[model samples]
Target: MNRRMAVPEQPLLRVRNVSKIYGRSCGECMEGTGPERESNICPKCGSIVAGGPISFDVYPGEILCIVGESGSGKSTLIKSLYFDDTFSSGEVYLQNYEEGKTNLLALSSQKKRRVRNCLMGMVYQNPQLGLRLDFTSGGNNAEKLLTADWHHVGKIRERAQELLARTEIPIERMDDCPKNFSGGMQQRVQISKALANNPSLLLLDEVTTGLDVSVQARVLDLIRQIQRTLGITMIVVCHDFSVIRMLTNRTLVMKNGRVVEAGLTDQILEDPQHEYSQILINSML
Candidate 1:
């Protein structure tokens, strides 16, 4: 009997103490007669609002969901991880081609750009925003060919068709514009484009939030299937616990821009230890 060797999993990405702060602050109050203007200071206290830091690791072929309410640092963390915004502090480590961990925060803008498209894929909340609405589905998917050495449109078209098929969208819709499709169809097309790069890690930011309940379930199922079939590490940001439970083995719960709990999904859902997590769970019921 031949024995298959166990595969060793490497840390594909690590984020430590990552934070971002908006510079805007409350303007000065009006006349003293009126109530004191609400200070935009930290809700936790009167002290300066120091943006929260996020710490986590995404392993190879694993799905990690960062769950929180709106403005709870879910999107901020994803944006910082993708280097879309300047992080105030902390480091991001990514597995490099040389089998070493490289600090993504330390990379130059040009280097970061190179890393963003090839090593990682991001699906924004608004699918149409990520794609050129004017372009046909086929054209949008083939657009990446301009940046890559793969200039053959025929190959790009074939790959686009395959991706569309994988997402359960008919290949006949390849020539149609995204504007003509329903929101769910548009999202599927966006996934197709994101997969065009064949990235090892995919970051999804509330990708199904805007869809109907039925469409949301379908989208979540498709995502889980894609992750399993592609063996790609995915970090998803979502507020829906149902979606997280269906797709992820581990979960990170956040409250007021801070991670209140982190552990196996079942444990967190069943025996939540943190006060915030307890409240979140109770409210869900």
Candidate 2:
């Protein structure tokens, strides 16, 4: 006789009406690279400007797909949650907010850096952007674990090699830099490094966009398998409707920086509520 295993349940993270604004008429808003151009509020209407107030929750052992087209604010949502940008209104709650948990929107700059790279890992669309082109794949992977503070350097190196093998990339080729690896191979390395510290939340931002159709399928399957085994919560940002359907249980559709439709994967696909969602479904077909 076979016995079923018990699964643990917990709320991993939450985002509550996060809003970010760039420029301001009086120069009071946060000044930075991407937020330098837009006004914080409408001078004429006094309406809140820049990033929209966005809210969402990430449950343990669940893959949440945040779907939207270009400029629909999907990227902004991720950036805000990771504290890469400042929010002008509302707050982002992490792991028990009411009990005075760590405020995602209020961490110091240095703490934010630590939280992002270690506690929450992010995989960009372009793997090269995340990897050190000058370093070998093994070296790049090892760098992520530096934050882990593993005293035995040799053991860390061995662990990095093991990761490459686990991701199906031959350990022998670990010496090759990301520039030498194909797009698909580079993506695998990125994933291995993103999982360096066994993060609870993994933000995958269109991680398989540049790969070929066959490669995309393989990467998606690998992600599914890994998530099942590790029980990591993920927020996959993608424009491709089918990709979300294949990987996620629940889906949130965004249009013009706001949630238009959200529900179970099958229900959203079978009977869409928003016109944009309908167009997305038709395109996927």
Candidate 3:
């Protein structure tokens, strides 16, 4: 009997040595900045290394969390992944995009727009960034669908209604502007809008920040439900360990624009190996 080897699953998203620099580099930028250097700024060139040499793989349907204090560059890393801010160097590949042969950062603006609209979704910490304050909640979702080429008004409306309901928004409030809704409601609307296209990957950057504790719990529960039902991969950037523990299957601990630790979420929480990760876990208690 001949036995064949099983093929390994490919990552849905792959990032390698990705870095975003804010100023001109002195050729020693990476060498001078990182966790060991205790800084994200290059002393020789005065460049702010917002993030990178960051490398990680996100498997399909897995929820990965990036945790760090303010200025740890976790948010910057997520934003760069979405092309909200251009990264200075590195390769990013999506398995479904160009067969993972193309580096996303090298794509043209038009192609990047296509990727953003079709393959990926983002939920920002602030609803204002993700939603049109003056547009009706349904209208905001329609805008996203429209970008993805959903032209039929009736079908668009139907999809919008479905998403709103899924996110626990009242169907009657579909016509209401996000600005008029409570913060938690606004975030729910944002989530619905981001999910309008049924993106393969979702990027959530502190989505529960600033909400009441109970509201946060509801929102987090909604997210968990969505992931369970849709099997969508997610990369969540959050400073709170509790949120990370609640949501992520795996975790990355970042400091000074670099990842200091990466492992199973429960394992990392139970026994953080890095000093900064230990400090973070301690602070959570």
Q: Which candidate comes out best when scored by lDDT?
A: 3
Candidates in descending TM-score order: 3, 1, 2
Worst 10 residues of 3 by lDDT: 1-10
Query: Of 2 and 3, which scores higher on TM-score?
Result: 3
Name the weakest run of 10 consecutive residues (lDDT summed) in model 2.
Answer: 29-38
- Give one digit per residue, the lDDT tens place, for model 1 in 1-285: 001223247677878877555553232111111102222244432332223566888787778889866656678788777777777668888876345466778888988887887777788899866788889988888875454445777888888888889988898988999989998988888887778888888889999887999998888888988987898888999887777778886789876556778988778888999877787777775
Of the two candidates 1 and 2, the one with more favorable TM-score, higher being better, is 1
What's the C-alpha lDDT at position 67 in model 3?
91
Relative to the unseen true structure, what is the C-alpha lDDT of residue 189 in candidate 3, on a scale of 0 to 100?
Answer: 96
* Residue-level lDDT tens digits of model 3 in 1-285: 001223238999999999888998988988999889999999999999888888999988888899998999999999989989988999999999999999999999999999999999999999999999999999999999999999999999999999999999999999999999999999999999999999999999999999999999999999999998998899999988888878888889999999999988888999999999999899986
lDDT of 2: 0.75
Error of 2 at 226 (Å): 0.7
Candidate 2 C-alpha lDDT tens digits along 173-240: 88888888888988998998888878878989998897899999889988988887888889999888
Model 1 ranges off by over 4 Å = 1-9, 24-40, 43-51
* lDDT of the candidates, in the order given: 0.74, 0.75, 0.92
